[model samples]
Target: MSGSHVRLEPLTMDHAAGLLEAGADPGIWAWLSSRQPVELGEAEAIVKAALTDPDRRAWAQIDLASGRFAGTTSYYQIVAKHRILSIGHTWIGAGFQRTALNTEAKFLLLRNAFESWGAQRVAWETDARNLRSQRAIERLGALREGLLRAHRIRPDGTSRDTVLYSMTDAEWPGARARLLARLG
Candidate 1:
């Protein structure tokens, strides 16, 4: 579960404090999947429950430079047989944005998926209106697969069109090189 610039460490009771600290981000929550929790107590429950889910792989994001907990990212919709996976539920404090933190985190995940897990395709989906996220995923060299119209109920309980992006094993070499260049 460890990434290059961050570690996707297994979530545990001991991680409550770090989870709370990471979730303290208020600015980024507006466009994220769920709202940021208000207190350390609330984050603990959320992180704990997210980890207990059988279908998803969740982890804490650790910022290498500050040695501080940054946030959480997970691989959902993992179809091992099909070699497909999705990275979502990701959030980072303003301080960690545009840094090597996210690039390396993604590198690790992609590396593990394509090389370690033998996954053929890695997917990243976001609200179509979230231009920032769309750019970031594209920056990682994912192809603009298409948009899912009214794909899911948003945090505000409204339907949302999801932009789907993906990188396949055939594309991993270029994608990894791009991510590495940024991190370097």
Candidate 2:
């Protein structure tokens, strides 16, 4: 999906190289869902796994101005019957962070979920220690539901505390407005 600052294309093998190059920073993978891939091959493996996941719809985040691969994000844990899904496993390269790329990308994703898919809710979760992510989600107008202690095992083998947030269909209108303002 295209946005002012970025375009999200379906995640594919073609994106693997771009992702590996964009995410070369060692610090980028610190709090991400999976461990840092130490090399291009490992990064390719991560892309392969995302591609293989049955429940996930993954996308490659591309910066529009430079046509650079920014990162990856996904709509996963989809329960179509329940009209619920999650937007997570998102990570942008160092150069793209703090830019409008993320805000626009999220706007596109949320719009697709709530409007196109008729989703009732879109959930988001991040490591409790990730203040940046929490602030970003909050800026999107998603309500902080609660924390899920020991929600899952981190790539480093430690149990991770997750901060849960969600934006129901009822909340989407206001969120959409805020996003539009940001994009302007």
- RMSD of candidates 1 onward, in order: 1.6, 0.8
lDDT for position 179 in model 1: 78
Error of 2 at 21 (Å): 1.1
Cα-based lDDT at residue 168, candidate 2: 98
Model 1 scores a TM of 0.93
Which number leads on TM-score? 2
The number of clashing residue pairs in model 2 is: 0
Clashes of each: 0, 0
lDDT of 2 by residue, 1-184 (tens): 8977999999998888888888888788889877777678888899999999998999999999999899999999999999999999899999999999999999999999999999999999999999989999999999999999999888889999999999999999999998999899
Highest-lDDT candidate: 2
Please provide, for model 1 over 14-122, each residue's C-alpha lDDT reduced to its tens digit, 9 standing for 90 to 100.
7778777766767778777666778777777787778787878887788876778887788999987898999988888777888778878888889988999999999
